[model samples]
Target: MPFELEVCIDNIESLSTAIAAGATRIELCSSLALGGLTPSFGFMQQAAKQSTVPIYAMIRPRQGDFLFSPQEFDLMLADINAAQEAGLSGIVIGALTASGEIDTKNCRNLIKAALGMGVTFHRAFDLCKEPTTALEEIINLGCERILTSGLAPTAEAGSEVLKQLNELAKGRISLMAGAGVNQSNVKGIIQQSGITEVHLSGKGFRNSLMTFNSSNAKMGADEVDDSQIPVTQHQAVANVKAVLDSLS
Candidate 1:
């Protein structure tokens, strides 16, 4: 089987780059620096129009913890509706209980909202109290795949646990290793973890086009730096895709 390369993108430029570079899937989001918030409805619609491969809209409601209030859950359901209306092929979603287990009830509701579209449990899996228990819960929740880093900071760092998780999954669902994945370490991650699918941003920094400078003024949060924009590089994605194709 051909290995799947899912590119996580936060902007139209990166979206076009990933597609042009041979990405098999796209995870649409915004503010990837904050770990990816839900993309705007317009963004989703534009991505659906541009992507030939499947596009999965990230359904995260906010930037903080996965534990969400009832209102937040309602917002997620609305986002799912927007994804469907936008003609997206899938949705990436995850929610956790206060105690760190998968929020099965809310997750089921989200899954039900997604209905005909594909569903992937996002990296919130890494935040669970127990990896093994979380795996079973995710499989039971009916997600088509789980985007995880084996409960570690990066896929390369967690290859061993990823291998264990892959073995335990037994084809019940796909385990797509993500987090800090790049062209350099992607091959090793696939070999060590035995995962057929991988996720990455393939991002590289570029200075903004604006010639004017405002050193004292800022448009975002205190920590935000608008000088350099993070955009997915065609060469970066193509490099990883080449590796996957070679293994195929």
Candidate 2:
């Protein structure tokens, strides 16, 4: 079977670029630098309207950690509902307990809220204290897929554990290799991780549109300042697809 490539998009430009470049699936988000925050309703609406491929909007309320407060959890469920109402194909959602295990209670609630829409348990899987045990519980929760880098910073580096998880998954759920995936390493990642679905941003940095010396101060919480914004490259997306196709 041909491997599935799920492009991670954060804006209308990336959305158009990915769609035009023949992406069949996309993970729609807002601040991908913050590990993907929930997108605005208007953004979701526009993406759904313009997209020909399946778009799964991220359900994260904020950046920081997978551990969420009660209020934050509530917000996540509300966001899931809104994304579904916006006609998105799926929702990427995940949360962890303080002890570093899947918050089955909250996660199941989110899944229940999703109902007919597809559900992907995000990279929070990498933060679990007991990953193997967590996998069985996640499978029991009926998530459509799990996006992981095998508890490593990158899928290529985590290929060993990624392959192990795929074996344990045993077709009960899909294991999508993600994080630091690029054209040069995509082929090796697929061969070693044994994953059918791969997730990446297909993005490159662009200088701020401002010609003026905009702001000497930064606004973003992390090191990802606005000076260089991530924009998807149509050729990058196409190259990933082309490389994957060549392997098949």
Candidate 3:
């Protein structure tokens, strides 16, 4: 099979871009700025309406680590049920103990919530105590795939570990290369690691369409969040997909 292109999208507009560019799947989230959070129900519903590709909705409730309190964990469960009911292709989720171990019970609870839908363990795997152990555990839990950078800062740098994981997995589960995957290096990562799937945000900057900008107004709590908005460009996505096709 040809390598699959999965694009991370944070809104309805980005979903449009993903479809226009012929993405194989969608990892739908809300706040890409905070490394993606669970999206609003309205936004997700709109995505379901607009997106042609299957969406793997991010099931996080906040911006921090995978560890969640009881209430937060309950909320995540609710999000999972809602995401599956909302017609997303799969649920992307993760939870970990402070010791950097998989929160097996909670993860199982979440998997049950899916009631047999697809699941992808997200980058939280990168923060686990051990990748090989976690891979076995995730496969046991019936997750379809895992998105990781192999505990490194970027997937390219982590390709060797990714290769090791591919060998370890032996087709039990898919290892999706993400975090810094692009057209330039995507073919190399796939060739080196033997991972046939990838994830990325085909986002490009665009100035906010505001005639009169408020100097003091700011959406984020930062020094300067210039209105150079990050929007998904279909051209970038198509180019990356083309590269993957060529290699295949």
| Index of the highest-lDDT prediction | 1
> Residue-pair clashes per candidate, as listed?
0, 0, 0
Q: Model 2, 77-150: lDDT tens per residue?
A: 88888888889999998899999999999999999999789999999999999999999999999999999999
lDDT of 3 by residue, 123-190 (tens): 99999998888999999999999999978999999999999999999999999999998879888898
**Poorest lDDT segment (10 consecutive residues) of candidate 2:** 213-222
Candidate 1: stretches off by over 4 Å: none
What's the TM-score of each model vs. the native?
0.96, 0.93, 0.96
Tens digits of per-residue lDDT, candidate 1, 18-118, equal 98898999999998989999999999999899888999999999999999999999999999999999999999999999999999999999999998799
Residue pairs whose backbone atoms clash in candidate 3:
none
As a TM-score, model 1 comes out at: 0.96
* lDDT (Cα atoms) of all candidates against the true structure: 0.93, 0.89, 0.89
Candidate 1 clashes between residue pairs 3 or more apart in a chain or in different chains: none
lDDT of candidate 3 at residue 171, scale 0 to 100: 96
- Model 2 TM-score, all chains together: 0.93
lDDT of 3: 0.89
